[model samples]
Target: MSESETTSLEAVDIVRILELLPHRYPFLLVDRIRDIDSDRSCIGIKNVTFNEPQFTGHFPTRPIFPGVLLLEGMAQTAGAICVLASLAKSKKPEQVYFMTIDKAKFRKPVIPGDTVEFHMTKLNQRRNMWWYRGEAKVDGAVVAEAELAAMLVLE
Candidate 1:
């Protein structure tokens, strides 16, 4: 609602994103959130660094960002949107569970020092289930995308 948030490029620190998502340390794919619109949409940013564990064996010497990891980043970014829309303060991320992924594609290889941005938008909802479509990019070039589905599980 504020001018900075309305501008659509605000940055979210890792701690803030961790508060909404269950991922952490080595497994947390997203580095920060740049923007979020509750349930409507979310943009997450990740800075790939040479220190990542995957770089060791993903190639041993010439590391190419794995396509599945890119897809995972996109899904996690979308998951952050879902959490903000439905579970910002529930104490955990399993309250909403991912169910399916469809129509996924990879267009480029993401490498170290690249900052990837994942943009996700809500497509629809069915009862406790939510559907989203997303794209991941680096330097405005699409690196990955998918039609994803998730279910909000309650305790």
Candidate 2:
């Protein structure tokens, strides 16, 4: 794709994200999605905050965003784009179920006030299932990564 084409792609905001994903507050890790290339790739953003509920129990004096949530963010990012792609085809699924997580690793701790980006790239797709490789980054540095697979269940 040309640079211009990439730049022209519109971002998916929180409102549309809410419509695409079933996760609610505290669980909804992705705040915004951008640089979408159909179901091929996209970047999901999550702004970490000090007042979030997990901070109180995750740690009292020191709070760090859970690594598990980072993985979930990656899955959500991939799943949302999958749903968006299906919607474009006029086939809406009843639910997107997370099927698997593999090769997950945490390289750094994500703390309050950090804006994490989940960069997801499609690895494969078959029938109603899709697989993606995701890297979680903070300040352009990789903090975590994983391979996630999900299935779209139609009604």
Candidate 3:
């Protein structure tokens, strides 16, 4: 889609997020999307809770959200941006697959009741591949950060 066309969108709710991405319960980390700047950047929300399945096994007593999941959430946000842009241009949804993750760092331990905000920015796009940089924050404090690469498969 043209820059202006996709940039017209300001936010995407759970319903739209469900339609744009394939992830479902237990795996779908993004609850809502806001501050979308077309395919350039976006913010994704994930509400962490004690009842989450991962917490049951990841740490029965300590219960810290997994770092890898944080990266996955950020990647999902980037994928949402790509899907939204593609839908705007072709009216067809595509699947985004993780290609690589680099320089991932965990800055803090995310526990239950913490709401994570995933901020993702597109660094570049070449053909079907997209490069992104993302950070996961809890209450304005960064918990994780990473550089991601993904491939968009046209369906």
Using lDDT as the measure, the top candidate is 2
For residues 110-135, write the lDDT of model 2, one tens digit per residue: 99999999999999999899999999
Evaluate model 3: give its lDDT.
0.90
lDDT (10s digit) by residue, model 3, range 54-140:
988989979999999999999889988888887777747557798999999999999999999999999999877789999999999
Against the hidden reference, what TM-scores do the models get? 0.85, 0.94, 0.94
- Report residue 42 deviation for candidate 2 (angstroms): 0.2
Candidate scoring better on lDDT of 1 and 3 = 3
* lDDT digits (tens) for residues 1-155 of candidate 1: 33334335356678877876777888789988876666677788889998999999998778888888887887777776666555444433456566889999998888999999988888997656788898998999998989988776655
Which prediction has more favorable lDDT, 2 or 3?
A: 2
| Candidate 1 displacement at residue 136 in angstroms | 0.6
Order candidates by TM-score, high to low: 3, 2, 1
**What clash count goes with each model?**
0, 0, 0
- Residue 122 of model 2 has an lDDT of 95
**In model 1, which regions exceed 4 Å deviation?**
1-11, 88-94
